[model samples]
Target chain A: MKILLSQSLMAYLSEPWPWYVSGGLIAIIMVLLLFSGKNFGVSATMRAGCSALGAGKINDFFHFDWKKAQGWNLLFIVGALIGGWIASTLLNDPEPLALGSRTAEHIKSLGLSLPKESKEIASGFLPAEFSKPEFVFSFKGILLMVLGGFFVGFGTRYAGGCTSGHAISGLSDLQPASLIAVIGFFIGGIAMTYFLLPLFYKQILFPLINELQNSFPK
Target chain B: MTKAEVISWYRIQEMFLFENFHMYGVIGTAVFLGLISVQLIKRFKAKDIDGNEIKFEPKVFSIPRYLFGGTIFGLGWAMTGACPGPMYTLVGHGYWSMLIVIAAALFGTFVYGIIRKKLPH
Candidate 1:
């Protein structure tokens, strides 16, 4: 029964429904946001919360107590993470996303070996290597996590919002800065993933993976 | 009733879950409509809370506040996959366990509110 279920589920994931449905739903949300007199900005919600915290009191972060503007925005941020996890695991849904064979080969060329038998790198279950708590807490892993956190925080602020805010909401509103920022974001992402990330992953993260694999019981 | 019963219940529940699954298209259309709606509202002379046009203005924006506030936002976003807009949608889709991130976000906000007095401009 599980086999039959998995097969049909795989077929469904291969369909284009995931992208179409999720994208449409977000568009509906964008319209709702404009109606509410609030702009859809993920980063601004954080600022409002911080200012409400009294950022303006000590160093002039919240000069007017922006807390009053705060409402249900933070709740949205929490939902996205939960949504992504559930989408990957519980739903067992196919995302219809796959790295092409050439791209797969390219990924292998970077020295991070992928499973040869895997039809598509994207569809595979989460790697067992990543499941270990020690891997998450290791020197390189922890540094990656923390540095990733800091860079995202600083970048979102510098760019005025994260990708979704600029790409979805700001673009919807035809905001010029959001356009430029969104372009910069994609450029940055491509550059990091293609060039800098590979070197870092191989030199820094790979050894950590090897060490953790040895320590853990397979 | 029991674990097995709960599993059965979930199976039954799946029958009701809308599986249109048109993820990207739905998101794109919704955003486009939302933008159009905002434009319509503004052009129709809709009175804002302050009776002004719904325009984006930089003069009224505080750079320092924006910078600091944005940092907190980016940090949370990086740690978690979802940002503001997607968060609620996730909840509506029944990812109830996400309440943890929501709680942390709220706590972060509450902490900032408490310290608003000591922060720099």
Candidate 2:
């Protein structure tokens, strides 16, 4: 019986599951959370952590009974981490990420390498550019990392939740705030992809990477 | 594996770029199930492990709050292509770059904690 279970598990993990199955599972997990009188969110863990680590001494926002209110939230995140471990280590497939052709071309044009049409199932989840120490230590990398991190952290706090918080829990509760937040998220996303991203790459990121100012498109 | 959950965000990115519809299907189905599950949980008056009644309070709203916050968050999302949950997944996948992102994010959170009193909730 155990052998049969492991075999099925491998089969399920080998390929992507259909959407409904994943969606239904997410709903079920949310239900379990709600039934236990808990709100589900990923960003809230920061608040809980800050409070636990004595940041309450500095700001009233961190001053709370986090162990009682947010202890479970922390546990949930740990579970997510463990689940991530299982996903990457055990269930991982050697398939190259199936990025869209246009997107693939755009990234390639940026001088980032990806799996070409020939072969070589991408060994890792991201392109090799992301894993390189030189990329991480680059000036462009520093700006993107710092600014990107700050924006995600501060914005989630300012918005009272992140994507999972608003899109899932807030929307499940039928809140106007979540609806507005979700809309704003899409708008921000659109702005970034269409305008800021290309411009940043051309003006600063790409130029800084190659040290070639003439690479800018006319 | 739940790595697909991590991939789903980029699927949204892909959708915005006019690539595909699978992410929409995933979100649609999840949200649909979410609505139903929330209603059922409320109707049944489900209890917790501690035997407390489960409830969802109505959330507060402000026009500018979500607009500004979400837009900022979206930019970061675009920058990283993954949010908090997936950040860990990236680490699990052995990408050292994500640690840099996560560290900066924690520092951001700490700064927020310091100034949170001044921010409008």
Candidate 3:
């Protein structure tokens, strides 16, 4: 019975739903959050984590009553992680993620590798070349992860939100700051996609791929 | 998990790479719905679940502030190919290297905490 139930569930999970199904669900979540008098974002969890660990003694930003201010955000992240695990492992479709032709072409043009395409490497919705440990622990990987991570971390806090915070909730709230932030995000994204991204591939990742590649994401 | 993979792919990958219109379709739907919902709620003066009057706090707009911040975030996001939310989901997806990004993001947040007062809000 359990196996039968899971099989049916898997069938539903694996099929692609229309964009509105997900989009409508996302909007409903935002509406729910608004109705609860809470704003949503992912980066806020860092502050809560720090405060929860009593980092407030060291830093005022972390010195809030995190249990009151940002406790729910932490739970959100925890739930996301566990829920992701369940979906990735148990409820997952055995077939690899299907990439659109354009994206596949773009990945190849940029010299990026996808693990889903490679039978030996196992990954879920991540670029094998940039995300796998073999690349992560090396010179190129270190630069990419460290520099990229620093930008994400500092930038989100400085701006008062990340993608979800600014783009989803902030915009939904109809704030002007969010509009500017959203524009900036697009400009930066475009610059990276067209300009910095090519340079990174040509100067760093491509050459690094030639020189290394030892382990997998397992 | 489905949300993370499907949504992140469209949001970060497709949008950044200019791959297709699907990302736009999805995001636009959400934003449109959200805009309408917010308007209706305000028009009705809907109270929150706690029965407090729902409010939208006015943000101080400075051209340089959010622009710089968001651009920096975008660069980081493009390089990492995952934003703050999906970084955790990627970890659950078994991309353990995302831990490095997670640690660095926390450190960055801590750094921001240290200098929060120095920067203009």
- The interface root-mean-square deviations, each candidate in sequence, come to 10.1, 2.1, 2.1
The CAPRI category of model 3 is: medium
The parts of candidate 2 lying over 4 Å away from their true place are A1-8, A115-123, A207-218, B5-12, B117-121
lDDT of candidate 2 over A1-218, digit per residue (tens): 99999999897776666777776777777777776777778888877777887888987888999999988888877777677667766776666556788877665655556644323322445556666778778776677777887788877777888867888778877889998888877787778877787788888776575666557664
Instruction: Give the Cα-based TM-score of candidate 2 against the true structure.
Output: 0.88
Global CA lDDT computed for model 1: 0.48
Candidate 1 off by > 4 Å = A1-16, A49-58, A62-66, A78-99, A102-131, A203-218, B1-35, B45-121
Name the runs in model 3 displaced over 4 angstroms: A1-9, A118-123, A204-218, B4-11
lDDT of 1 by residue, B2-120 (tens): 11111111111111122222222444565576577657866785655555556644322344544454444443343333444443433443434223444455444444545555664
Candidate 1 per-residue C-alpha lDDT over A1-218 given as tens digits, one digit per residue, 9 for 90 to 100: 99999988866654434444555555666555555566666666666655665566754544654645655566655555455444444553333233345545544654423333332322232222223356446664455344444445445555567656776777676766655665555445444444555667687678777997999988
TM-score of each: 0.58, 0.88, 0.87
> How do the candidates rank by DockQ, highest first?
3, 2, 1
Docking class of 2: medium
Candidate 1 is graded, for docking, as incorrect
Chain A TM per prediction? 0.68, 0.85, 0.82
Ranking by TM-score: 2, 3, 1
Clashes of each: 55, 0, 0
